[model samples]
Target chain A: MSRRLAEAFAPGSVAAQVAAADWRAATRVAGELLVASGRTTPAYTEDIIQMLEELGPYQVIAPGIALLHARPSEAVLTTGLSLAVLEKPVEFGSKANDPVRLVFGLAAQHHDSHIEVLAETANKLSSPRFVNSLLTIHSESDFQRLLSDS
Target chain B: MKILAVCGAGVGTSVLLKMNAEKALRTLDLEAEVVAMNLANALEVQDAQVILTTPDLVAKLEGTRSEVIAIEGIFDLNEIGEKLEKALG
Candidate 1:
């Protein structure tokens, strides 16, 4: 079965609070999406935050993009992928690539499964068209449709 | 041969690039071990004949002795394979 990616947006949701300079805020927002979408539990949110805190800032990835993820057992309730487009980009280490407006969060039951999905999503994101479409998407439905089409 | 693919977190783009590289190597009649890792662990992973990553990361990894291919776009398997062929040869 194809795992359908979901979107979660709430007023004052973490996704909306991310600033171009706040990496921690972006991670929190990503965690909120996981919890709201039923992909994770409330208790696991702290674990996600911890991973970001320990591995975040510089020397992780570039600045503009934040690859927020956790070990399979720490928080993933299922196998799925999700995306969040920040109204403003945030930083996550990579100085050359900071101020990221797009946050792609991944969760899987195991290592192999996580890698498989990551490979597919990465291939898709490499496409300029796909990246452009993702940036312009305005709603959860739009995001869902993009995943479905892929 | 073993090729270690690297990116920011060893979770997103790097893993994806590993998948693409595996597929491309098969078509090229090349047998290889493709593994993904965070940039921090690249030096730790011995036996990597080649290191594949984005241009931004590649720039940071300059002056390395290992063969390095800076993929402008990791999603494009064709481009990735072409680059691999050049590096592998």
Candidate 2:
């Protein structure tokens, strides 16, 4: 069976309406939350940045959404998810999916781990209505509600 | 038939794409051994018939024998299905 988003979500890892000047800063915000939640080390953030700089921003999976991650390493404490919603959208240099506002930082212990949560996330984010609700959420509780939605 | 799902790190989005590709293949009434691997490893794969990845990753796959297809939306099953259909046809 597929896992729910909440199953892999890190506790207190949600940051709402973060003021980020650029996509890097927005990714940093998400990474920090992941670090604070004990899901990953600070090095994971730099790894993600390096991956983007070296390979490109293919992590911008859809319109206004970006999923930040790197290869599974010692930096990742476990498989967990963190979220950061920007106060204003920023570009990740992807021509097709640009002006990203929602950033999800994922730290997986293995290559195949967390597939269920990732699928759940993909299913939800693929819907425009769910994306809009996540973008417009006013509080962390509201965000939780949206994330926990089946 | 074989399909390769690729990304910068084989661990993240490639797995997402791999999952969707399997679903797309089922929707298209097809079958293939879909594998997700990092760019470095993917460069060494000589058996796959198709490689699914984002557009930016396409330029790096020049010497590979597989037909590279760039998918814009990793989560969009319909897009994946359509692209796989066209590629298979």
Candidate 3:
């Protein structure tokens, strides 16, 4: 996963200390990362937002973090990710974790044998040290470094 | 024995949970087939003994033979392991 997933969290995939009035804005910004990276189309970003509206903030899988994504569709061209850290956390109406600080936008395909990719990404985000640094991270290199060290 | 890890999107979180479940099961020194499936298709997998998921998604499966384990923090492996320990104890 270290070498294979490096492209997912590539240099331009990070946005730090962004200011958004609410979670919707926050999510839109985060989802757009996939579009900018050419991993997914804008429609996929809309799918992510629509998923939130239809299913609630179920993507807020952990405290202070939300992993945004939808099912595989024509909107997704490849497996990639975009990450965003907020200046001020916004509530996504999650019962367990209300305010989210870190948002990971995911676009995964069925092929490339990406089972390891999902596992590694989930493990890295859940690790205590990585979560701590992920909140304070200001650069893509730092984010890459943590994933690399893991 | 079989354990199923489920999420709204079968491709992402469930796959991750499948790996995490493997780790937790290893720690418990228990052997079981672990499967990851999306919520929409999970109900069809009736052979699973236990189903793991987030609280909100658990509500989708109200009455079922399989034991449903819902976690507050879906990403926390410690919480996941502890809950599984208590349930499978």
Q: Best-fitting candidate, measured by TM-score?
A: 2
Off by over 4 Å in 2: A1-4
Considering summed lDDT, which 10 consecutive residues are worst modelled in model 1 chain A? A4-13
Please report the candidate that would top DockQ against the real structure. 2
Query: Per-residue lDDT for A1-150 in model 3, tens only?
Result: 478678666556788888888988988888787788778888988888887787678788778888888888899888888899998999999988878989889887763346666666776765778888878877777777766676
**Model 1 residue B70 lDDT score:** 75
Candidate 2 lDDT over residue span A1-150, tens digit each: 233567677667888888999878988998998998899999999999999998888999888888999889999998899989899999999898898999999998888787778877887777788888888877677777776663
Candidate 1's displacement at residue A139, Å, is 2.1
Ranking by DockQ: 2, 3, 1
Clashes of each: 11, 0, 0
Residues A28-123, candidate 1: write the lDDT tens digits: 666677777667665555765675565443322323445566655756676555456787765565645666877755655565666555555555
**Candidate order by decreasing TM-score:** 2, 3, 1
Best by lDDT: 2
